[model samples]
Target: MVLEQLEQAVCPQLDYDYDLAIVGGGIVGLTLACALQDPGLRVAVIEAKQHSVAASKGQAYAVHQLAARIFQGIGVWAKMLPNIAQYRRVRLSDADYPGIVEFQTADLGTDVIGYVAEHHALLAPLQEFMQGCSNISYLCPVEVVKTQYQPDCMEISVSMNGELQTIRTKLLVAADGARSRIRNAAGIKTRGWQYWQSCIVAFVKPEKSHNDTAYERFWSSGPFAILPLPGNRCRIVWTAPHEEAKALLALDDVQFLQELQHRYGDQMGKLELEGDRFMFPVQLMQSDRYVLPRLALIGDAAHCCHPVGGQGLNLGVRDAAALAQVLQNAHKNNQDIGSIQILQQYEHWRKRENLAILGFTDLLDRVFSNDWLPLVVVRRLGLWMLRRIPVFRVYALQLMIGLRGRIPQLAQK
Candidate 1:
């Protein structure tokens, strides 16, 4: 009855400048806008930074199969495919452990397990695609000043190219990031903690071919990952204690490569630093709520998890696809898109799913990133089970590549 009253209270006579307005034009935000390319619904994306700035971050992500399908649905996968490196196999091992659990495409019955693409490879295509989208108004270098929630629409005050303007939309989506200003302004609390670890990431050129294989080797300190990229190059994510990570970053390129080689193993042969190294503290964060009246949160704004399995961006991609489905359905039914009743559909669909990944990553980090004798034994045994049992291996692979959740229609192959 309250929902009915709220819907009725919204005057049909009032006009909104856009049906949906998204803040933060990063990968997640752009994915959402691309997914909602409907002629009937006008969408606006307000970003504080330029695309060039974001693309220059020198970071890369493991793009799961579901996320690839979402991009395919949005018609950007082809553009991204050439620039990405597809890894058909993944090797999971522990510090100096002879028993390495290897996963192949056959394990998941897929052509490729996942793809790795640099920040520019993904962001440039999405930005170029947005240029041709008529329904989307891309406003970059625009700062969001404030947001006012009205009974019928969301009033967003933004400073665009030095001019201040208020844009009205039926729904406001925040994909800004983990430190989202929009989310904080809405007073939405998050539940998680700053991990004791930080991750140092850099690109390296391997003397030999990577053979399209990704590696995750765990140590007492934290997890280290080698993600294959095109041109026989690889992106490495090295996690360690905060101060230790800082100290490692202080080393010269040759010294840094020496330290990296110790953990990276001899599988890829000699390695040379390809670019600047970057580091950031790791954390686990989940919003207490994902929606409020006319507002919604997706991507890093909604949750963050450890990079143990490279699940961060994939989660955000799935969030964009799922929320897109919900909003598209509401629009089709001619319902109030920003109604709490409608927005809750998105919250319910993603919150538990995201929580599951968060728990899985936290458990993996805790179990493997310590030398506790009991945990060490348990993890070794667990890894043995994963290696010996076909069912266990398949289930684990599915989860890693995002096949275990309630997949959205947009991501459906």
Candidate 2:
């Protein structure tokens, strides 16, 4: 009743349109909405499902130092602090190598390498916080049926509670996920292929504390990762060849647990699988274009990378931060935020950045995902060299945290 009255009271005013209309209510969309909120502009988020009722679940995200800083700028760090699980170090090992290379915060002169947290926990507080921001309006549980772009604005028609409504906004942001409907509507093409592997994720209880450390073990078949959670529980993202994954997924609880132990070894001690296992097919996809006219894509909508470095969510956060900075800069300059010129600036800055990272990461994935003798020797030697050289280590750290050069404005904030 209250929502109905609120919508009714504001419907007339909404007819005047908004400065920005964000499609998708995920973290990227909401973050963009909050970032663009101000007295001089109006922003609206059109979500296909109620925030609390959305069934889509994301994998565990590693909050890199840069991404954490961006979250702080967006006023979500403090709210997310209590729920985060600190990972003070990372240990990377190759099956062919006798020595493991460890990345520790103490060595890097920082408090922690990064953080790992469930996706849902991070978004809960963000949703609650958005309620008090007056400049943003959320129209949830509504499906966007059609969208038309004019020279000056994009008109979107959505069906809310069985009625069709149209919204005209200067800029349209598509923060939708990898299978982005908005991207398709804009005729953007994505180029990539699915990996013949599947990742199985499960929660397990370790016999000993992880001590805020994460581990990544690369085997011939694939990489097995054990990321520490808040308590004794650990999250596992184990990848395997398609046939192996199918066989593993078909195993019973006891059989599955045994396989996990055999593959993971006794690093943290005995592991008791705690949650039901889930599998996701791996893919490496990148869009041909990130922006077009008054529309821009962010997050998984723009690119999807391998999860080897745990950089997927970090990359998405960077996208949101960068695009937000671009829009904010235009707003400060008294320029239209939705103008094609303004949107192109965001595309220019983000395209090269994401492309470079994507290429580098793709190379890493190919190099590490195999068991060829020559490639194994080279990678093991490279790891040894990286561990011995301080300058090389720092460079690697910078690349891992997405802090290689001048930090983005939103990240600095």
Candidate 3:
């Protein structure tokens, strides 16, 4: 009802200014819009594609224990609960080396270690939630062509239904993907490199039950992860060299299944491909600064890392929660949400966490992706020690489940 009014409340010829304007309607952007819902604030979401069009773009996503809690707080988890498939434990094994590490929910006295859901599953529900919130204006089928960051407000020119429209907002959030136009427009530089590897993703069904266990097997090529999905289905993420990824994508289903069997064994029995294979290049990108004047970067706009750990989206969720709380409080206090101070506070809270997770994933990639004898020995020894060390076990479990450190209020259980 509120969104319907937002569509007709103000004429496009008049001012369409908003308190907050978020670019990109992916999970991160939509979830941020959902978090920013307040009767006191007017928020606008700009996206180039419709929800159905965007839904078909990405592969599955793993929602860690912490990410799920964040969703629960945002009020969309209840709508998404029926769509998720829980992974009770996660196992990491080295195919060439004799090291296997397992993280189980039982050890932490939790019901689930994490969960896997298609990227669309979360986004669709979140978009629905946003549409119903009166404070949010769903500006869809729009392409942002011009962005101007002013001293007090940011102006955005977008083409909606082929007709150009201009909107202004006090705070502009770049929830756009890796190549963020908003971040670039803000002149926030980033430093990172693309890895030589690419990942091939596909949905498959094992002949036997998966038993809701997620597996990450490291080989000389790269990391091969099998994430559990509901109904005895699994999603395979095989990160190999660019050449190897090309070969895997070109292979026939029989050959692909045979290769997977060779690497993963018959733990889940025969593997049958259930969907078309897709491949994407992997990279590590972190913005130099997460905020600039009236602009803030969140999700892929701020940082992006390898998918070997499934922490990408969860990291963005934490950012949204922290930023939303900061902005909500600032609005209540009659302070500017776009002020450097408030944005800096959000950046201060999330910068370390983002960099630390990036470093951790990078370390895992370097240690496990190479076949150097000395490094392999050291890595194996570390894993071996972790298994026997009680204190370390507890810590590792907490880290994977996203319960370590000072959690944001919205993400806390």
Candidate 4:
């Protein structure tokens, strides 16, 4: 039953083949299918693994309001909502600086600020929805070995269930990820750099209850975020420079806890580890072009930003919605779905917001991860003054809620 759960996140009619062929059936790919499903367009998702294997790579993600609405539009939110933890309050603080700012869900007049849920929790339901969609076909346990971009159609060659097969479509959407095969074969160039820092993550139980509060503490080392989870447990994402991250990874549970306390203080009280710890390098990546010929890139394939705001996945989901909107509109007008003209519209609409977010997150990491006196003073003053300025405070609150410029129609509830 659990294995079959991801089958119907989208709905459509009977079709063996597709008009749009999606590579990499990760979150963005599945979400794109769901977003495009309501229109009864034929779609096929080619993935590297079958349902069971791809369904449960247990990980966690914090979903912003914009993305949550996209999931609701695709018809899986109602099922996934029960397993999510809502953040009632969000606190931003610094280790060596006196700057502190707190944002409340009450201030925004919303039932929830945002959600923290396991990656599999979100993936399973979307996968289930996909299975039930008649017009959307799934090609699982396959690897994309060759991709050909033609003037009229795109061809993706894969080894499916131990046999070689090629799928032809009007458009090819890449949702693979940072190291995207679809992107590379399409000759799309990317520009980004490794942050020289790594993220150390783990789940832990704290002496004091998190009380549905999310805390992000900035230190010269990097930003450390402790997001609340059910049962008084917390998900910790600690961004530290390379050496520090390696040291943290090498420590015994007690030693690592001690170091965490030294940097994070006792805000959540004594902490105890729950699961395995992990260290991963963080980087910024952006494709030179999101569309070329009949091919398009979405999600991590198009862009990636710092995880400071937890906006990477949300940004990717927005791409899926925008692309689906353009394709849906083009279909209504009886235009070529993969035409250069139609794909350009999707590129233009998404690029504006994507660039702004990349810059904002980069600035957050650079500014907060420093001890430069003058800049530190200015940042601290800004945070302290924000509390007294009602209008400005509201403006900042809205940005955190993913309510700023140019939201996709599907993202609107």
Query: How high is each candidate's TM-score?
Result: 0.97, 0.93, 0.94, 0.93
The worst-scoring run of ten residues by lDDT in candidate 3 lies at 5-14
Tens-digit lDDT track of model 3 for 83-157 = 879888888887755567887776788888889999878888898898899999888878789888776678889
lDDT of 1: 0.91
Inter-residue clash pairs, candidate 3: none
Any idea what lDDT model 3 has?
Answer: 0.84
Candidate 1 lDDT over 301-330, as tens digits, reads 999999999998999999999998988887
Worst 10 residues of 2 by lDDT: 5-14
lDDT of each: 0.91, 0.80, 0.84, 0.83
The candidate with the higher TM-score, 2 or 3, is: 3
Top-TM-score structure, candidate number: 1
- What number of backbone clashes does candidate 1 have, counting pairs of residues 3 or more apart or in separate chains? 0
lDDT score, candidate 4, position 357 = 84
Q: In model 4, where do residues sit more than 4 Å from their true spots?
A: 1-16, 96-98
Stronger candidate by lDDT (1 vs 2): 1
Per-residue lDDT for 25 in model 4? 89
lDDT of 4 by residue, 1-413 (tens): 53332222122222325789898888889999988877867899888977788877656778888889888877899988888888988888877556567888767788888989887778888888888888888888778899887666777788987788888788889999889988887778999888978999898898998889888888887898988887888888899999989989999988998997887678788888997998878999888999986788899999998888788888888899999999998778666777766788899988878888888888889988888998788778777877667677778767755678677888776
Which tens-of-lDDT digit does each residue in 176-196 have in candidate 2? 889899999989999887877
RMSD of each: 1.4, 6.6, 5.8, 6.8
Report the alpha-carbon TM-score of model 2 versus the true structure. Answer: 0.93
Candidate 2 overall Cα lDDT vs. reference?
0.80
lDDT of 4: 0.83
